[model samples]
Target chain A: MSEVKSKIKRVSALKQRGKVLRDTNPLLAVFQWGCNHMMNEAELVSDQPLILDRDFKAFSKVQVHNQYYNEQELPNKFKVKEYCPVVFKSLRHRFGEDPADYLTSICDGQIYGGKSTGKGGGDIYYTHDHRLVIKTLAKEEVASFHHTFKQYYSYIVECDGDTLLARYLGMYRITVHEKETYMVVMNSIRPVGIPTHRLYDLKGSKVDRKASDKERAKDLPCLKDIDFEEAQERLYLGGDTETFKETLKRDVQFLEKHNLMDYSLLVAIHDCNEQTPGEIDRDVDVYHVGPHAKDLKADPKRLYFIGIIDVLTVYSTRKRAAHAAKTAKHGARAEISTVKPDQYAKRLLEFVSSMLA
Target chain B: MSEVKSKIKRVSALKQRGKVLRDTNPLLAVFQWGCNHMMNEAELVSDQPLILDRDFKAFSKVQVHNQYYNEQELPNKFKVKEYCPVVFKSLRHRFGEDPADYLTSICDGQIYGGKSTGKGGGDIYYTHDHRLVIKTLAKEEVASFHHTFKQYYSYIVECDGDTLLARYLGMYRITVHEKETYMVVMNSIRPVGIPTHRLYDLKGSKVDRKASDKERAKDLPCLKDIDFEEAQERLYLGGDTETFKETLKRDVQFLEKHNLMDYSLLVAIHDCNEQTPGEIDRDVDVYHVGPHAKDLKADPKRLYFIGIIDVLTVYSTRKRAAHAAKTAKHGARAEISTVKPDQYAKRLLEFVSSMLA
Candidate 1:
């Protein structure tokens, strides 16, 4: 083992010497050799029309997507300071050889805003060779992102028998011309069709069915009597509204009984005058808000829920809690308090139950 | 004129609509059309080398000098945000066609960072076409940057009667790799050599015998004995060191008599440490600490200097005085005192005269 280590060290020493030779005159042969190595390995990610057709099978679900553009049609201009060139370098370094290719594979090249399904950064395009078209962004313009890693990773661990949002692929920042804004690129599961359980109003049902692992593990909240339009109205135009705490409380209890996951919900309100086709929850993704929750609330459409990871529960909790948080904030500051994650979850569950009752 | 105004309003309306259309579907032709217009009118710049061979003239004397990486070696990499695609769409919406190209002309493509310059954001590379090689950078294992902008800009403004630094450029975020460490890029400035005056030694005999407008206009100080090394050391590692304060006083007086410019200085100190090359004036721009005074220590090899900006003196004085007033447990803080630009200049001259006497 020692001899092998020595051999490895010897090889490393030779590599170091070569690097020194290259730096002695970067204009020399060694520098060119490194550049060529990088260039040869990189494959431009070509642009693809959004996988709108839902043919998930044909898509690698993780294969590279390339974008191409005539120089005239590129989205961003070279900005010296804020939009400086080093951003490109940082991205390349982070992704390695085919950084562009790798990003293109997972990213959806669209300019998202309003009530997005939470996946967007800027206006991206694919080249014929699969190279991606990257543009400059500020903090507020991109749509939130929703990511799914389960399909990609095989080995999974159960932490307290609840699945958690493990990592983020990337985030989105947007530069708005009319206004300066910032938002995240988010990823969330899109429901193929409405589930049977969703159709029944959850207002007065007391038939407690035996908990199954599938049902318990799922993050969906029990559908209760809801007035979505009313909720939407209150959300768009700031005003007081009914609390869904009771409904949320019941569902949270159900989730707890099943040892379900913990997650958060965020809703983004784009424009008060413009009504979007989808809900903010549908458009945005699981964002890691290390702080800045107050700024997130500035968007009327955006409402967030925490400590429930199931997609359905995350969605429901967002919609219900957003309406509640908005109304509560007239005295909102009095109700919601940031606590330890576990304690916060318990309080959230109680809040939801009180609303339903 | 009325007709033209009406036309302008109509055009603005169309432009706004066009932006929304492209933003919604960046994949659509509308976005491509917008990009074309932006790029066509956009300015093109190069990732030229940061250093020049004395006579190289790709840039104006007022423009910055950049040293490009030897093509034989890896070019500087720039990492952009992943959601750049979405941001690109927004850019198109706002800037119209060829927005990217327009921005390119203005961008300097340099990254800056103090603590974690090269880590977390990953490595980036550049191609001859100016296309970026984006990569991921880790938060850990980053490299610090060495480019000096605040110092350079300050030096230029102080020594040369130029107000060019007022035309502020933006900052860039990038990552660089040197050996094993990585760093996140932050800011870059136009790299031009410091003017001869800013590099003068207060006590040195080699003074510009032919004084210019600003110098000739003032009551100049004739210092016979100045410690050039002490001045340089203070300039490199900032503190309210006795030598540094004295240098600032002299330099301010020089500016007042010669240029008729008014400014003040604020010296922030926490016990000073050994000088670190480019780290002294990280956030101290010309307007903040006054312009920089060049390092005229006998050892010409060292490029260190005292980077001071004028704005900092005025603004910081007001802020500091206010803060001091607020915290006073005694009588109200004395009327916020500050060194008026002219007064500052005179004081500097006085200090120099005293030192010489």
Candidate 2:
């Protein structure tokens, strides 16, 4: 009788344990599930030295059916599509990110939704460690990403992942209840354990380029070009200036060649003087210190994290029409967000150059 | 103001979600976590066709630290050790199990604890689908497993996974609060969606081989030799009799050569008349049907699952002492559980042959 009682207690305890794994956000839960699944599947694949042309078009899709008895707190059925797995895996290798560590950061712990949504109206999330960012993308943006992915991969390989462009880690499409959501994972431009005193999203455009009144009301608003100019903000890269400028020039030129434009230079400034002395996670926060921080002439009070983001947008016909109207109204010399790729790249480089001290 | 309010609501909702992932069973949670982590790490390894001697000794150990900010509902610190990964992986392949599917079966769903513990005092768990069984092992059993692992791997390779031996899938050691527990994963002998009307753990011994009163009180008690004899149970294998006997002979010889004894033949009988018509999962329940079931003089109402289990126990010094003491007490000719490997095998084969028709 005592043994039977103990057995009953254990079985009930397991039932209680099962209840604890319930999904709070089904979408995020599915996304994490897909990541864990695909990453494990990728282990069986043999390593290839060269990425094949067909690899760019390749994808793995799985539809999961959750049975009644299973403990998975997911929808009854959902589909996950991983695009260009080999290409993305190579990109991850190029970025020096360990696949295991990447899996742990995204799937092993909580994923927190961003307090504010992206300008593109996509939802944003951060890993528990704040080492990676996940952003939902529009269908057209996914198409645009596929269009530029080949050149983008080649550029990443050539640059050895040293450019200031966003380090894209993985791309996936998740479908639940017939609704499809495309998401991209990237290294977070902000470092952990450091508070950013000021942030700027620079597009080299002055007209309507300042942070909105509503945006400014937030504790850490993304300030813009006009705001940057208002504060006369400058980055003291010192000896690292030439290397930084050269990489930016090459990156923008590559984007121009691909007819990509309207990308922003996201700069986060951490005031070293204000923060308590602590060890910085250099591996995760790769952009925290410039390569030549030990070369002297460094600003002891400020540490900077800088990267180019939103590079997926292309200068389409609609953008060209908007540019023509803006040019007609404000004269051809007027600084605007939308312009020819060449002119946009040149203006961004010049604007960035002015910020260097 | 509305945006801020919405953001607050979202944050609070997420907090509520995090609270839902609380751990009711920290040990099981950690086991699941470790499986996910290790399986993912295994994906990054290059495949090898040949299993080396060192592969048996090889192991991977990881210590996980769950910080306050992380959502992992585990102890603050725990250690997981995976034993003979490459060898086990090869064994899985030999058994025609996909690594990815194996990972998903254990990690993607809830693992239920058995209603009754094993006679060895080990806790038992089954995958949500009931396709796999996980049993906690004593430290000595783990050591015994390692001792025979090389010969076991060779035997498995030679027989090509066709023998009626337990299909060992994975073994792991988990540590929490400075305490260690070893666990092994194996294919479940019983078929899914089929009702087993009678179960038996036969060792060809009458002395102390009968199920206890407590065991007999269960819904599905594991009967013994005395119980089987009293009921006059027989297996009508017909055409499969020779093949079954041949395989059993070879398996017993293998065990005898390794000085192992005290193993049992686990037999589960599913009475078709007692079960509802349903498709049996053949992939998971590989032992459900006999090799020559079509040529079977078999009972239409009965389907059998038979496998050799508990084969890790070696006839060591302690067992030799127990054999002498038992022989002295019950007379040398008594059908006892403990005996020399050669005598034990002969007695078991003779007892099993008598029940075959």
Model 1 DockQ reads 0.01
Q: Write the per-residue lDDT of candidate 1 for residues B1-357, one digit (tens) a residue.
A: 000010000001011111111112111111122222222211221112222222111111000111231111212231211111222332233222233432332222221112212212344322112222222233321111112223333443454522211211211222223222221211111112221122322312222222345433433211111323334323333332355445555555445433323232212222213334554453353223222223323222333333333221222344446546544733343221223346435554454344331
Q: Please, what is the whole-model Cα lDDT of each candidate in the order they appear?
A: 0.26, 0.72
Cα DockQ of the candidate 2 complex: 0.02
- lDDT per residue as tens, model 2, B162-207: 6877888889988888889898988877766566799998989889
DockQ of each: 0.01, 0.02
**Worst 10-residue lDDT window, candidate 2 chain B:** B8-17
Give the Cα error of residue A102 in candidate 2, in Å.
8.6
Query: Chain B alone: TM-score in each candidate?
Result: 0.24, 0.87
Q: Name the Cα RMSD for model 2.
A: 21.3
**Candidate 2 residue pairs in backbone clash:** A43-B43
Report, for candidate 1, the interface RMSD.
25.9
